[model samples]
Target chain A: MRPILISCHTRPVIAVKFNKDGDLFFTGSFDGKVSVFWSEPVERLGTFACDGAVKTMTVTEDSKYIVIGTAINGIFIFEVETGTKVKTIEFSSKIHVRDVEFAMGSQQFFMISYESDEKKQSVVYIYDFESVLNREQPSRRDLVRRDRDHYYRGVWGYLNKTIVLGTQNGIIDVVDTKTGELLLSHRAHVNQITSLAFSPDFSMLITASRDCFAKLLDPETLKEIRVFNAQRPLNSAVISPLMLNEGSPKYHCLVAGGQEARDVTTTATDQGGFEITFYNMIFEREIGSVRGHFGPVHSVAVHPRGHMFVTGSEDGTARVHILDQDYFTPAYD
Target chain B: MADADYIEREHIEATADGTYKITTHIKIQNKTVITNPDIERRKTLPKFGDCKNLSKGDIEGSINIEDKEVFLQKSSQVRAEENITKFNLNRAHKEKLDALTRRERAIMSGETEEQKTRRPIVTEREEFSVKVSNLPDNIDQDVLQNLFGTAGRVRKVFIPRGRDDNLPRDFAFVHFDTKAEAEKAIKQFKDYPLGHHILSVEMADRRNQRRNVPMSNRRGRK
Candidate 1:
């Protein structure tokens, strides 16, 4: 059990992000909007909107620009301080870029697209943003298309040492970033794995699945360190990286977004009703629970400072909350 | 090795022009002026059903609930003078009767609140409820929810709040979304012993008597 952060509202959360400073976090949902909030006060600093459902978000290592992924397959780069749209990346209709990450050192970034079908085939496209924009036919082709059997959902590129790939099979495959080769594959749940995160210090990889299991795994070898099967399906989980700070940065928390297993009769998982839950790893207990949505919870992203997190869910809501070790508090700023 | 594979010229269509005919090209008309909605730059968090909203917009609330057979069966027969369409009525009359009464605000709201308080207390979803009984003076809601959590899609599974040495009744109620789920759970757990007590998993008491149930045998509402 460990301390974690959670957020909930009446809408389905589509994406969540921790700004570079860890001082602020952002969230977007099906409602076609995004919000920035102060971690400590939990106040809304600003709000923005995209063309459609914001599917994913990636805050550059420098935190200069935030890349927002929309269900319409368009990526918008927004300035952190000014809340301005700096650039736009568009994809052809055939591809839906579901997740994106800025590699270590912020030299390049990667985006993965999930094809909505039973095959659940996907592609991994790597790019050096500035370098690719210089090309005449910039969107000529993807850098690499993943193989068929290796279906991937979420990607976490930490220090370029570990590449965490979540699969539709509820497994987390940690690959060596240097070699682009598989290092470890752990079956973390009985349902499709929805989201994963790597700690800032690169010691932990958190995995969440529709089977209701939120797991903490050893980042290096992908060993299952702890499993919190709340008996509730989850869509995504993100771990706060600032825990490595010696000053007791106040968070080593895991946030899971998902819902109660639907069709409990068939019990096939992916039932989709969910709550954003905070787990205290050291205590091995759930410290806080935020409930509001009527659908599945999807993503949880902590602010860089380890104080608060923004969560997304299928019910079309995104919520933000602050962490109070003594208890969980709502930061309504 | 020469004859192992004979490639046909037509099998692979060779392109002869600057670009293939099937090339994906974006045809753009030169525009002297551009016009679009100047909504917020962040395309998220719009008001429910705002024009700029994306995806399916917000959910329609809990207005749409699917009713399976078990939900109807366990709902009880209404027993006496109820306003619902009586059984043995023809299908057409039943439909008309249901449609007419569902329009009545008083009747409509009457049942909803009852449904909300589902179990004696709030659990997960309203359709299901769980309560515990016969504990040796000590037990908790955690013991009950965890006990029935693995059974099926638990809407709400918890032990109803009790008083000193008193039980919520010597029984627990486990509510599930679908009657099939409830039935599945009953087959697997009913009559099974949880410590010293035999669990009787059955359809919830009829909706009509749920309130008056305070007079029931064991943990009747005081």
Candidate 2:
């Protein structure tokens, strides 16, 4: 894999997400902008200015809309093609919007709100896009209330049926999206379960935790299959998208990155930079690592084509890695 | 009331532009203040009922004992023997009950000691607690216990959980046997990297010391 450094954000890059087509990717930064880039050409397409530093962001599967959230600024929904502001959602300014995830194959999106007011603290809400497009106030349903002691940082919709929330207590709370009934709750790690990424077939689920362990688990039973130790506090982990009929051995590989467990400073010159570890699902061993960022890696996203991945780091850069070596070599030749 | 007897009169002639002439007269009547001890004593008693006799009991009765002895000598001898046997039986039963109670108490105390050994010995000393912030999530209890144990005998390490999530909020209160030990830990571990973050060591604020302040609810872009 070859790394291409993208130095667009002036501050720490918090989020990196690729659209379904894999032609475009988005990077949100604490510099108060969400930069869009053409993946193949690796050129900056445009940048959207937010009211405050972007904390989290997501683009729809069809790439029709982009939703960005900030700590002080309200959530903004924009039409991707026209780059026009679609809607502005008003929430308590005290809230730190942590996760913005567009639902798979739907016009609905889920957002995890944290550090909010007492009335709506640590809540995950599902908002309908059709309502926002109609210029009407979007209808929302509260999927989970993570008040006080039950804070959740990550949420993903499983099979578009149930919503799975990764809690601060290292537990996963599976809730029925329609009925809002709690189906199951189990501890996935010892510390905060930071992120959850599901496989393409929806069979195996991977979880990253601040406990320095990334685990492969059965989504239905929430049973641990294997543990990949990172020896650091992982903030994000993503499973590579399935390679279509390619028969590539690297399909469904896990890439996880986060803070160094020992080195506390952000500007250490030694082996102190953030590390991205890759694990092969078939071989069940760490296959490789990516290290370049001077600060801790905050997030990682895999392209839909599974040829490349994007990683956002606290060092204010989002790096693009082309996973298929042949794709780059053929071009150089 | 203080006694006063006097008559005073004042007159004012009307000016040319004044409405009317005015005359005023003041008189004080002779009066005497009551200083009897009986009135003050009566005022202190309850007002609803008879003050002195209300506490006294009215009903009284007593039964007189008959001098006649119905039992003959043989019956009386049997009764006396029965009474002695019943008294001895009651005494023995009471003694046995006392012994059993004492044994139960001893067993309970023994169980308490066992429980004390089984339970974690966390000393309740708020003064000797040092607050440590920026703790990495992966750092387990044993690591913290060993780290803080070097300073002095750490009584307990309490990581405050979020109100709803039950997750440690990246800070812990380490209590030592003495304030000196807590101070030592603060001096040693301050700004040192324990896990993923540099430790911010300080004295812990008292429980509930943070007052509830209203958060600003300003919405939308300025």
lDDT of 2 by residue, B1-222 (tens): 222454545566678787564645456665888764532332232211111132222211111112332110112343355566655654553465456445446564776546555344432434477888899985676788999999999876766566576566788778677788988999999899875699999987644312111111121111
Query: Each model's TM-score?
Result: 0.51, 0.57
Q: What share of the true interface contacts does candidate 1 keep?
A: 0.00
Candidate 2, residue B161: the lDDT equals 60
Q: For candidate 2, give the docking quality class from DockQ.
A: incorrect
TM-score of predicted structure 1: 0.51
Error of 1 at B173 (Å): 64
Backbone clashes (count) for model 1: 55
Q: How accurate is candidate 1 locally (lDDT)?
A: 0.57
What is the C-alpha lDDT profile of model 1 across B155-214, one tens digit per residue?
A: 654344445654644555666777677777767776777777676666666453244234
For model 2, the superposed segments whose C-alpha errors exceed 4 Å read A243-246, A249-252, A260-270, A324-333, B1-222
Q: After superposition, how far is residue A318 of candidate 1 from its true place, in Å?
A: 3.1
Candidate 1, residues A1-333, lDDT tens digits: the string is 122223322345677777665655677766666766544434345556678777777777665677777886577777765576767777766667767778777766777776655555676666676654455344423533454534446565555666677766555666665556766655555557777776777667777766556778877767667766455556677766556656544344665654443443353233333556666675555555555445666677766656556666665555555444443222211
TM-score for chain A, candidates 1 onward in order: 0.78, 0.90
Query: A11-101 in candidate 2: lDDT tens per residue?
Result: 9898888877777788999888887766764655556778888888888766778889886777988766546677888776677777777
